[model samples]
Target chain A: MKRILIINPNSSEEMTRDIQDFATLYAENEAEVVTAKIEDAPKFIETYQDEAQAAPGMTRLIQKNQKHYDGFLVACHSDPNLDLMKEISHKPVVGIGESSMHSACLLGDRFTVISATTGSIPNKEALARKYNLGKQLTSVRPLDSVTGAVDKLDLCERVSRDAIDEDGAEVIVLGCADLVGTSFELQGRIGLPVVDGIASGLSTLLGFINQALFISKVRRYGGHV
Target chain B: MKRILIINPNSSEEMTRDIQDFATLYAENEAEVVTAKIEDAPKFIETYQDEAQAAPGMTRLIQKNQKHYDGFLVACHSDPNLDLMKEISHKPVVGIGESSMHSACLLGDRFTVISATTGSIPNKEALARKYNLGKQLTSVRPLDSVTGAVDKLDLCERVSRDAIDEDGAEVIVLGCADLVGTSFELQGRIGLPVVDGIASGLSTLLGFINQALFISKVRRYGGHV
Candidate 1:
């Protein structure tokens, strides 16, 4: 059986548990899913500075654990330092933000990401630009909630519906790993395809695991390696 | 030293050479890229009937050669019989159409596919819908070219420009495998991201090879495997 390492890239144990549970449940009988987090990282990754601060810890974690895992999934919606992580690791390292956006593009013509706060919108937009999904992205709607807050479900559903109606969003992506299990309910309420970044990341990692695939180190980093 | 079998699905040796050359060039030192085609299939797959006719021969090719290769790529942009091919094979089976569409999604917000003929538009639309990129698709523009015709470059450039100017296409995907090697020129002329399906397919296959990844059999076929 394949083993996947899911790095939360944050210090929050609660968020780590949520990511682990979601990955383990979906990965049932396909592979073993394990979750880890940097002890020195921020409790929440909400800003560019937060992401920058968390990068070193996340990189160290991957370097330390790359040998035991078949593939790696970075569980943050921002996908902090994904390129650098992939460059150094021997395994296939996928970012949740990248995987969900790619999966959303496959699922719909335009997608809206529901973020944890309005402050997160700019970073998400930058990511869309980096991935070349800027035009395909309808908008980034904020839930105005802290990580692991289940009470924002109604607000999320309402904002998502508005995104579909006003922004012409054909799909919705839950942009925070903390919002792992909310996609199904949000999709049901909003009547659009809802993607959880954590699930998409796990599924992508599983695909790599089932095939024993990895990033071509020779072609990566300007083919200098 | 992974090997990828690129099956053109059609019987045209010229098209096969084009695919093999593209895959081999871009794959440089990454994997061994091999190309094949169905001996009795149509010269070009432009319709549902054509795809259906080619399916059996493609299936036979995969079944016979599945053991020698690390992965398989269906070289046709229509991704003929991709599901069935994946079902029967032990390795990752990616279709050029799927790979191009997925890659286009990563490189741009909205994309237009340039087809060989107007008759191929409906089929390309169906593929977009099948992959859930229907809404993200700006339009499907036809080149009005017969298969293997080099004279349609001007027409392709014109239609792609219109797609960018009028249809709001952020990316251009050459919808026919025969149109390989036209992307760089088209990108220069049209000022939009131009994606060549064959190259994208090979790159995706190489990523899987580097990681040894494949589709999870248990999840691929209604969880019956």
Candidate 2:
């Protein structure tokens, strides 16, 4: 079976557990999933500074586990240090933010990302621009809560409704890794396609491994070998 | 190694050869790429009616080969009978148009499809809407040549330039399967990301097989055992 290492850039044990549980459930039969947390990193990555600080820890985790894992998934929606990880590791490395947004593009035309807090808006927008999805991205709406609280579902629903009715969004992307497994439920409530970045990341990574597809050394990851 | 059957939905022997050569070269040492053509299909499918006429032959090919191939790639960028094939086949089935469009979304933001002729413009537009990419799709510009003539590259370059300038298109998708393997050359001249649907289809299909990811029967293909 393929071994997949899911790295949560933040230091939150709760978030790491949530991601591990979700990955285990989905890939139970086909692949072995191992989830790790960056112990020294910030508990919540809501700002660019937090992401920057967390990068080294995430990078260390990837470097240590690169030989053991068949693939690496940067579970954080912002995908901190993804390019660096891909450059250093010979194995396939996938980012939740990139996979989720790309999957959203396939599911619908206009997609809005539901982030954890207002502070995350800029990072999300920057990611959209990095992927050249500025036009397809309808908006990046925040839920204003860092914790993945059940109570926030109502607020998320309200924001999602607005995105659909007002912003003309046909798809909703759960921009936080903590929001894994909530997509199917939210899709039912919101009456639109909902995407979970964790799931998308895992799925995309699995595809890369199954197909023996890797980041082209000559193209995307040059000069690193 | 995985076996991938690339079904050219058109009858043109030359087009089949082109697809076979491209798939074989790219997927070498990883997957066995097989290309087959529908002998009764039109030499060129520029309209919905032509696509319709070709469906039965393509369907028959899928039914006969479903048991042998590990995955199926509908070679036509129009992805005729895609839903039906997915419903009936147990193995993973991918459409070139869908794969290419999804890959383009990841490579860049907004994209324009370059078609074989003006007659294909309406069909391409309809596909963009079906994929919910009406906004992300800048336009479907034709090479204005049905014969796959090399002279049309200049026209393609000019139209692609206009798409970048006027439509702000960051990626260009070769809408026809015959345009496979030309993206790299075109990207150099156009100074933007260019996508070949054939390569995208094979890559995506390999991902599906590697990950064991499939269109959930409970969701996409209900009641079909």
Candidate 3:
């Protein structure tokens, strides 16, 4: 099995558990995933203030565990510390936010991110710009304050239609780990691909693992030695 | 000087001369550029049928002259045989469509593509998908046939603003070789980055050349033969 590490940039054990469960449930047989939470990170990241506070904590986590993992996944939706972590780590690192955007782009001509708050829009925009995904973004819609705080099942139908009928979002990116398995309901309503970022990241990590294995095989065969 | 070849994939000698003049006028002092037109191809590419007719001719041009060029620019905005050419050529090859979309994504938080005809909208959307650029695209707008062909200057201004103001396109991509140098007026009008695909392709090619040089130097000096 290819050993991979998934780092949740926040200290929330609940969020860490969400990502861990999803990775464990979906990762291919050839893959093994481990999850870690940054002990010093903020509880919730609904704004840039939270993002800035979370970045250094993530940096420290990767710094401590860089050598043990074959590949890394930054599990936060904002992809905090992505560039800095990539510069320091020898292995391939895939950020959940970037992988979701790439996966969504692959599935459709355009997609819009539907997130929890308006405050996080700029952060989403920043992530889009950093990963060269600014062109495929259709619209960024925030769940109204009432909708964001209420039970997700109550709001699922409304969110799906708004993403498709109003914004013309051909692919729907569930930008939060909290909505992990809501794809069936939402996609049924929207009649388009509803991408779960956490799942997409795990799948992308598998591809990277295969790439690393191919490189190792080439080296063993004396092709590059 | 770095030698670059810009190939106009269609039989339009008029368009070929226009692209050659633009490259000669703007390319850096360290870069030398030459332009060639495929003598047998379509007149105007407003639909997928035109692209299908033109692609084989472009493949022939690249096959015959791939060895001498250090880098290549596909001057046609439709980018008829770009990927096939990349598969066969040793040098870095950039399609104006892909290069401009990539550059526009880097320059701004969002972009919109404006094309000359409604039939070409799907073609632009397909280009975005092929390059994995659909995520950054704000919208694809089409200029009505009468306005596009008869009112040339007015057509450019209207298309630029429609992308920026109405569609939330922070970077405007001029979608055709016929739109060359129109980015200047568009940038002035839109008050944001307006990318001329031809120029963007040239800039990206220069970057590829520099990277190749650096890799060559590293292989020679940092390793044993």
Cα lDDT tens digits for candidate 2, B9-32: 888999999999989998886699
- Runs in model 2 deviating more than 4 A are A145-150, B1-8, B11-40, B43-74, B78-94, B98-101, B104-225
Considering only N, C-alpha and C atoms within 3 Å, which residue pairs clash in candidate 3?
A134-B136, A135-B135, A135-B136, A135-B137, A136-B134, A136-B135, A136-B136, A136-B137, A137-B135, A137-B136
lDDT of 3 by residue, B37-149 (tens): 87767867766677677778777777777777788888877787665666555566777887677555433446788786788888889888767677778788776743534
Consecutive 10-residue window with the lowest summed lDDT within model 3 chain B: B213-222
Candidate 3: stretches off by over 4 Å: A1-225, B145-151, B213-225
Cα RMSD of predicted structure 2: 7.8
Interface RMSD of 2: 7.3
Among the numbered candidates, top DockQ falls to: 2
Identify the leading candidate in terms of lDDT.
2
Output the lDDT of residue A73, model 1.
Answer: 90
| Model 2 lDDT tens row, A1-225 | 999999888999999998999899987765899999988889988777887888888878877887898999989898788877767777778889988887666444578999988988988999887776777788998887434545757767878988877888877889999788777677678666677887778877775565444553433444444
Which structure is stronger by TM-score: 1 or 3? 1
Better of 1 and 3 by lDDT: 1
Ranking by DockQ: 2, 1, 3
- Residue B98 deviation, candidate 2, in Å? 4.1
Listed in order, the DockQ scores are: 0.06, 0.12, 0.02
